[model samples]
Target: MTTTRRPGAYHCGIDAAMDVIGGKWKVLILWALDERARRFGELRRLLPGITEKVLASHLRELETAKIVRREEFEEVPPRVEYSLTPRGVALNEALAPLGAWGREHVIGGTAVTPGG
Candidate 1:
């Protein structure tokens, strides 16, 4: 999976970072993989709203960015797992503050009420 670089694009560090992790699903996928390696099905189960195709696409993009590593095992049924690479770990750490903000602010407003 090779991406063609656009001429004169991504002039800043934020540009480069967003190029890798931009989108609703990519960051969520990275968060899911932060704790431990997970198989394809496990990831799908973890992220309830994601469709199979979308999850597959995001995983491919993360793998291409070298943020996530895909490991295949030789077995009777063939097994594969996805885990965060060192780069991904660093990225996740960098996102901690943002995550905290979302949890403290965003989730509070969006959570459902008992009768509403």
Candidate 2:
């Protein structure tokens, strides 16, 4: 996610995909946006450990990737909402099986930690 690729620069499809979602937070951010559009504050509340700086940076990156759409409304206090684009929705659908695998193997079988 830190590096941008030029056209045809990837060795393979997975390489390109990983480049887009390589960080600890990117996929989680995508998942958070899976349901509906949310304001910045809402996203902050959904993800507890993320700092404002990191969230803002990730959102900007995601926006550039065309996976997240940001819309700002003219209002008294000003409102900005973020949601998945069509591509993002398809990406989430593709991630569904991965999520199910994690639920089956990682979450279901793992031993509990102290507060985890």
Candidate 3:
């Protein structure tokens, strides 16, 4: 898989991080796998509005980045599952405060409309 995320080219840690997860779906994918391993169909159900192509691409990128692990089981019909790696767990944990802030300021708390 060819990517522009070269080594030593990032200006900061966040820059490098964003290069791996710089999309609308990657972070959501990470969050979905935070609890337990899930099959492709399960992940699709968990995250609504994500196209199959985008989900497949993000899964590939995350796997390449070592943030997600994919396992294939040998059974009647090939079974595959996706789960978060340790690094992914750490990334999710780091984003906890941001989630809390969003919940407080945007979701459960006051609804701040723009240009109000």
**Can you give the TM-score per candidate against the true fold?**
0.84, 0.90, 0.89
Clashing pairs in 1: none
The list of candidate 2 runs beyond 4 A from truth reads 111-116
Please list the C-alpha lDDT of all candidates, in the order they appear: 0.88, 0.89, 0.89
Candidate 2 lDDT over residue span 1-116, tens digit each? 24475578889987888887778888999999999999999999999999999999999988898999999999989999999999999888988999998888778978456887
The candidate, 1 or 2, that scores higher on lDDT is 2
lDDT of model 2, residue 58:
91
Instruction: In model 1, state the lDDT of residue 14.
Output: 78
> Which of 1 and 2 is ahead in TM-score?
2
- Candidate 1 lDDT: 0.88
Candidate 1's residue-wise lDDT over 1-116, tens digit each? 33444546879987788888887888989999989999999999999999998888889888988999999999979999999999999999999999998888767778555787
Residue pairs in clash, model 2:
none
lDDT of 2 at 116: 78
The per-residue C-alpha lDDT of model 2 at residue 95 equals 84
- Could you arrange the candidates by TM-score from highest to lowest? 2, 3, 1
